[model samples]
Every structure is written in C-alpha cells, then in structure tokens.
Target: MEFGIFMPNSRNGYIMAEAAPQYDPTHKHLSDIVKAGEDNGFSFALTMSSFRGHGGSTQFWEGSLESMTTMAALAKDTTFMKLIGSVQLLLVHPALAARGAMTLQDISEGRFGLNLVPGGWHPGELESLGVWPGYDYNEYRWEYATEYAQVLTELWRDGVTNFQGKHFQYDDLQLGPLPEGGRVPIVAAGASDDAIKFCAQYADYNFRLAWGGIDALNDIMTKFNAAMEDAKRVVKPYVALGVILADSDREAEEKLQRYVDTADLEAIEYMYTGAVTDTAKGGTSEILASMDQKGAMQMSTDFLVGSPSSIAEQLDEWADLDVAGYMLVLDDYVPDIKRMGAEVFPKMKNFDQTKASVA
Candidate 1:
C-alpha cells in the first residue's frame, strides 16, 4: 500500500484567537515535512487548497497558500516523494485546473497527482472569485466537477477537448506534454451521494474521512462496489485520512486528549455553523465526539499507533479492509515524521510489499 501526508493550507488548530494570526505562509515547515516523508518511505505529500478561513466569533482566520503554487514549491524542495495538489474543482474551470496540474507535473518531473474536491465552503468565496454560476450548491458543484473531470481527461490524453455543461462551457482545449504516465491519478473526496457517485464513476482513487469503524468503512466499500458495477466501471481503491502516531496505547490517549483540549472548538463550531458547507449540520461537540469515537478519541482501530511491530500489524489489518493507502495527519510535523520514518516505516515497508504476494 502507498502512504502520504496531508498538509493543511488553512488553519488547523482547536482554539481560535480573536484576530487572524499570521502563520508562516512561506511554509518553512514544509521542506522538513517533505524530507521526513521521503526518508521514511512515504509515496507522496498531499497539499490542500482553501480560499478563505471560517470566521466566527471565536474563530481564528489565517491566510492560505494557493495549492498549485505550494505544490511547485514543495516539488523543488523535495526529490523522491510525489506531491498531490488538492484542487476544488468547483472553484476553477477544468481547463485552468488541468493546466495547473500539468505544470506541477512538469516541474516535479512527473511527481504530481490531483485530488479533486467538490468544495464545502461558503458561497461567498466562489462569488468573490466570479466562479459561482448558480445556487443549486451540491448538484451544481457535482455537475461542474463531472464535466471538469471529462475536460481534464480529454485534454491530457486526447490532446484537445470541446465540451459544454450546465455550469461550464469550453471550446477546443489542450494540455500538452502531459505527465509521463499519460494520465495523472485523480482522487476525489466527498461522502454525499453526488460526490460519492462521481468518484465511483471517474476517480482513480476515492478519499474518505475515517468516520466510524471497520463496519463504516465496509459499508462505504460495499456501496462503492455496487455503484461501480451499476456504472459498468471498476472501482479503483479508497484511501482514508486519520491521525496515526503514538508509541503506546496510553501515550496515544494522552496525545489525543491533548489535541482535544487544545483544539480550536471555535473553529469547529464555525464549521458546523455554515462556515463549512459539508459538515454544517453537526454540532461542534457532536463532530468532536464522532471523531473520537471514529478513532480520533484515543487512536481508533484505524490508526497505526503503538510500537513499530504493532503499527505494522495494524497496517496489515487495514490492507485487508481494502484501504489501498493512507494520508496521515500529524500535530507536530517534524518530530512525528522523523519517528515514523526512522522507527515505524521499515516495518511498514515489509508489510506493504508482502500484501500482493499474500493476495
């Protein structure tokens, strides 16, 4: 199985200050994060894009770096590990996003991938960018993304594509000298019906947040399998995002509780209050509780926590669960990355390689 790190471009803490805090926009922590991943044998580092911060009374607003630019910067900073630019398909036209993806691929010597997000933020961001065409929200976003995927595929593989859709229209478009693979792997994320269906239809990999337990993941896998069969397409694989670090169960619990204690509850509350479109309904306490129950509490079964041997064994269990890969989130980027690489990775290397043979 492949592994990667999820880098947050937006604010990622539990507590929010009254005024927006100025973070290290240059992403000085990034080089170390990438180096740690590469040395530890990770396949890639995924960077996300968010245009604005979720502002609430208690929320902390922090500026974000653009996704494509950040990927290119990280590409120059690291050698072996691939980089993924998580782009919100609804924010920009497909042709433009494709060019951005292709440019990164060229700069990184074909070490670039795409994670297509359907968007889950306030409508004002799109309106400010002059990208919002209508207010159907979820449906409009998915339709735009569906066409976006079509355009990207056509431009990359077919040289030029002409297409029209409800939200976007384009004449002949071409993205040249595509990635060395001819097609860049595109992953899509969303749990809603439209988003899930889109991934089943076209994505090379589907991304999901670790919500419940084995049963929850199994339920999603079963649904995805059925959807692919109905569409007469084969589902590729699904990768999950989770926090996975701790040398012992006790240590894991302590670390998780620390995060919760320090967590910007205000930001989460804002997210539930429509600042984040997708997870708006759930209350902050409910969201936090769910994360805890879903393994975020004290390292659920989904996490690869504990000693190297134990973590490796945990990875094996996940492999059997049809989790082709994982994108790990770390509170302290450098230290956890170093320990994971120096201690945890060697064991995982063996575990990952032996899977195909076993299957």
Candidate 2:
C-alpha cells in the first residue's frame, strides 16, 4: 500500500492540543518535512487548505500557507513523489484552479494532483471575501462542487471549454500549455453520498477520515466500492490517520494523554459548533459525530499510538482491508518524520521502499 504525509500546512499540525509541538507555518519548515518524506520513501504528500483557524490558546490552524502556491514551489524542489494541493471550490473559479494545477503538473513533470474541497463551511471566511453565497447555499454546495469538478475536468482535458451550469459558466475559452501528464489526478473526500458519488465518478481517489477502527473503515470501503461499481468506475480509497509513536507503547500512551490533558477545549468547542452550524445538509454526519466524541483532537477514527512494532502491527490490520493508502497526520513533524521513515515504514508490509518512489 502507498503512504503519504498530510503535510503540516498549519501551525501545530493536526494535534489541536497545547502540548503538541509548536511550529510556524513557514515554507522552510514545510520544505524540511517534505524533504524528509522524500528521503523516507513516501509516495505522495498533500496539503489541506484552511482559510481561517479555530480560535484558542494554540490558535490551531489559525495560520496556514496557501496550498496551491506552496505545492507549486515544492514541485520545483522535489524530483520524485507526487504533490497534491487543495482548491476550495467556492473561493476560486474552476478556470483559475485548472490553470494553477496545470502549472504545478508542468513543474512536477506530471507528478501533481488536485484535492477539491467544497468550501461553504466557513461562512465568515467566505463573507470576508464577499463570496459567502448565504447560509442556504449549504443545501446545494455539493451540487455546485459537482459542476465545479465538471468544469475543471473539461478545461484540463480539452484545453478549450464552453459550458454552462447552474453554478458556473464558461464561454469558448482556450487554455493552453496542457499539463505534462495530459490529465491531472483528482482527489475528493467521500464524506456524504453526494461526495462519494462525485468521487467515484470524477476523482481518481476518495479520501475519508479513518475513524471507527478497521471495522468502520471496512464498512465505509464496502459502501464506497459499491457506489463506484454502480457508477461503473474504479476509484482508490484513501484515509486520514493521526499517529503518535514512541519507543514503547507505554511512552506513546503517555504522550497521547499529555495531548488529551492539554486539549484546547475552547478550540474544540468552536470547531464542533461551527461544524454543526456551518456544514451543509448532505455532508458526512459521521465526521461531526466523531469530532464530538474526540473533542477535535484531530485523531482519526482509528488513531495509531504505540511503539514502532505495535504501530506496524496496527497498520498491517489496515492494509489487510485493502486500502489504497493513508494520509498521516502527526503531533510533531521533524522527529516524527524521521521516526516514521526509519522505524514504522520499514516494518510495514507491502510498502516496498524500492517501489515507493513516485517518479
């Protein structure tokens, strides 16, 4: 199975706790982490786009680097390993996003992908830019995203697009300098039925939060695969994981407790409230439920916290489910990157280092 880092595009990575390693969201830090992943045999890396962050002591995700721009710069530096950047569909036009993705593809020599996010959750953020679309828009956010993806695919593949949809319109426009790969891989989270169908139909990969352990993941994958089969398409399944590792299981547990003890309740409350209030009707309710249970700790449903050997064993359980890959989030980047590269990855099965290189 493939392995990838959910690159820390925001401060404190995804831990959302005061005890988590604090780091600035800077290009240098990102470069270091990506370089470590490159040296370690990670297949790909993806950056999430967050316009604003939860308010609290740690300022969790309050500051973030622009996803596309950062990936564009990283493309010039990395020789192997695909780079996936996120596009908040509501924030940018499809034509603009398509061109930026093509530019990234060229820079990476075809090793580029796009992660599409239907961004209607943060009405405050959208309102700041005067594109909020109002609260009721949530009901049709997925529909808008469907058309958004259609426009992007047309522009990327045809080089010239002329189409009109309920949410977007494009005249006879010619966009040149096609990507090196001719087509860029698309990824989207399969949170709701609409999202699952959309990903099955258009995206090459579907990302989901790996909560509820292996059983939950298996159930989700079963449903997603059925949907893809119905759509007559094959899309790989990818899940996000939050990991905490140490020399021993005891040490790992201690670290996890520290994070839990120092959990930013204020931020967690803000996130949960916003999720319930701002999210649209068709979005994944499971995610909100999980967040409620976990209190916004950013731990995946199947969180991994153990020694290298135990972590490896747990990963084996996941691999047994036939998952395509994982997008990993960590409490700390610098040390954890090295640990994952040096310890856990070597013990995991099917992740042959020799074949991990993207190029």
By TM-score, how accurate is candidate 2?
A: 0.95
Instruction: Give lDDT: candidate 1, residue 10.
Output: 57
How many clashes does each candidate structure show, in the order listed? 5, 1
Q: Candidate 2: worst 10 consecutive residues by lDDT?
A: 280-289
Runs of candidate 1 exceeding 4 Å displacement: 13-25, 55-61, 121-124, 127-130, 133-135, 177-182, 229-235, 275-310, 347-350, 353-359
lDDT of each: 0.63, 0.80
On TM-score, the leading prediction is: 2
Q: With candidate 2 superimposed using the best TM-score fit, by how many Å does residue 69's alpha carbon deviate from the native?
A: 0.7
* Model 2 CA deviation exceeding 4 Å by range: 278-286, 289-295, 299-301
Instruction: Write model 2 residue lDDT over 1-359, tens digit each, in one string.
Output: 88888888887777878887877699988888888888887788899888777778988878899999999888876879889999988788888999999988888888888999886545566676687777777778778888988887878788988878887777886677877556789999756777887887789988888876788778878888888889898788778887889999999999988888888888777666656655544354436534643546763345698998899888877878867888788777768878888998889875678867844
